[model samples]
Target: MAFECVSRTDVGLRRKVNEDSLLVRTERGLWAVADGMGGHEAGDVASAKVTEALMRLPVVYGLDSMIESAIVALQRVNQELIALAKGNAQRTIGSTVVGLGIMNGRYSCFWAGDSRAYRLRGDQLIQLTRDHSLVQDLVSAGMLDPAEAESHPNANIITRAVGVAEELKVDTVGGDVMPGDQFLLASDGLTRLVEAQELASTLSSNGPAEAADRLIETVLARGAPDNVSIIIAKAT
Candidate 1:
């Protein structure tokens, strides 16, 4: 099986810097999205460093190896960012990350923080990665409504991310890859503004390129308040 991908990033209407970064390597069947914390220093730097590290991954033979390579890469970058922050006298410089790896007719998704991964199969749209944020925690514990979590004042407060702590814990999920399955990796900027059903309709009706364009257009039309980055990959 092979994969095709399309990607896009924008600074949005409110942010001065586009701190989100992404990776799209269809040949390797790997893709990722990283979003630097806006409240942290040099968010752009943190995110850029992450993609750079992932881009250097050597060719691997299987899905397990591919996922392991990605985990090591994130851990290495996590420590690098921690040191960088200490050098700059900052408390933390962090970024949320989500990645997708496909091999041997299967897909594995790994993530930290609130950056997300989703799968569109037929007419059903499933969120593959969950947010590691305060709002998500509250909702999980039944303290906050899922709908209200989006508009919560603490919505942006992620509980985990690269460079935020000495140890980075990445969450992962995997499944058999079916033909025509569509996968999306995106920063919270886009997900926060675009609803899942809308994303499902957009992705189902369009090809990767057009889907990417329409997703960004939707965010922009809503007066995007944060940097947005997205990648759409389809199995063939």
Candidate 2:
């Protein structure tokens, strides 16, 4: 496969801190976004550890292994966070994870929380990750409309996340690669600000780098509510 890539991250207008963290390892053909929760420095530390560990994965592994590796890494990060919290009187660090990797002409993705992954092929945009938030539960239970989910008071209260418990179960998915296919990985910061179609349009033109810029600009225009980070990869 052949393609180009570009990425961008920004601290949005609200929020004094950018708890979002990301990992882009082109050499390893990997990318990830971790939107940390909790207050204080704990969020930053949790997110950073998750990304850092994933960046060091084996040079080559099947989709299943990659998912396994990611889960293991998150478990480790969770333990680290719990230990940190135990040491401090007021520290709760948690985060959402969404990531993708390509190898041998195939692609793999894994996610927990609301950060999303998307595929653009032949003008069609497909969201690959499902939000694990409380709103998603409400929608499934017929308590709310899809649009209202976004504004739900507990919109950010995730059902699954890193460092929230002793163990984590990640949703892993993969697909066969195709030429001219484009992939996107983004944190909830951006996902909450714009719809998926809006993102697809920004990436419809330009290579990854330019696409990344356009995405950031669009979110900022929407009044960025949180730290936003985006990664784009094109397959040839």
Candidate 3:
């Protein structure tokens, strides 16, 4: 199967710089989104390092092998960032990553922090990755309402991310891929402002290019306060 992919990034209305990075290698069937931790030193560098590492990953066959390679690559970048931070007086420089890999009719999503992956199969839209933020944990435990999680003052406090600790934990999920299936990888900037129903409808009505354009446009229209990055891939 072949994938038709499109990607875009914006600094948004409030941010002075875009600290989000994306990768779209259609021939390799690999795509990713990385969001730098806001208000941190060299956030753009941290996110760029993530995509740079993923871009260098060796080609591997099978969904399992693809996921493994990505994990290894990310781990290396994690260590690099950690060491760099220590040299700079122990300031944390981190980034959240979400990636999608496809091989032999199957798809895999691997991630850390709050960047997300979603699948649009027919009329159904499913979130494939979960946020590692404190707010997400509270919501999962039923201590906080879902509607309130987004506005919680600690919504930006992520529990895990590359460069945040010596050891990084990345999560993976996968399933069989079908023709006409659509996949989306995005930073929280877009997801925070746009609702899931709107995402599903946009993906269902347009191809990769148009869908990506509309999503970014919607985020900017809603007064984007953070960097936004989006990638859309459709199987054929």
Task: Report every candidate's CA lDDT.
Answer: 0.93, 0.81, 0.93
**Candidate 2 C-alpha lDDT tens digits along 212-236:** 8877888889899789988888886
Give all TM-scores, in the order shown: 0.98, 0.93, 0.98
Write out the backbone clash pairs for model 3: none
Candidate 2 residue 176 Cα shift, in angstroms, is: 1.3
Q: 151-205 in candidate 1: lDDT tens per residue?
A: 9999988999999999999999999999999999999989999999999999999
- RMSD for all candidates, in order, please: 0.8, 1.7, 0.9
Which is better, 2 or 3, measured by lDDT? 3
Q: What's the number of clashes in each of the models?
A: 0, 3, 0
Worst 10 residues of 1 by lDDT: 22-31
Question: What residue runs in model 1 are displaced by over 4 Å at the alpha carbon?
Answer: none
Residue 14, candidate 1: alpha-carbon lDDT = 94
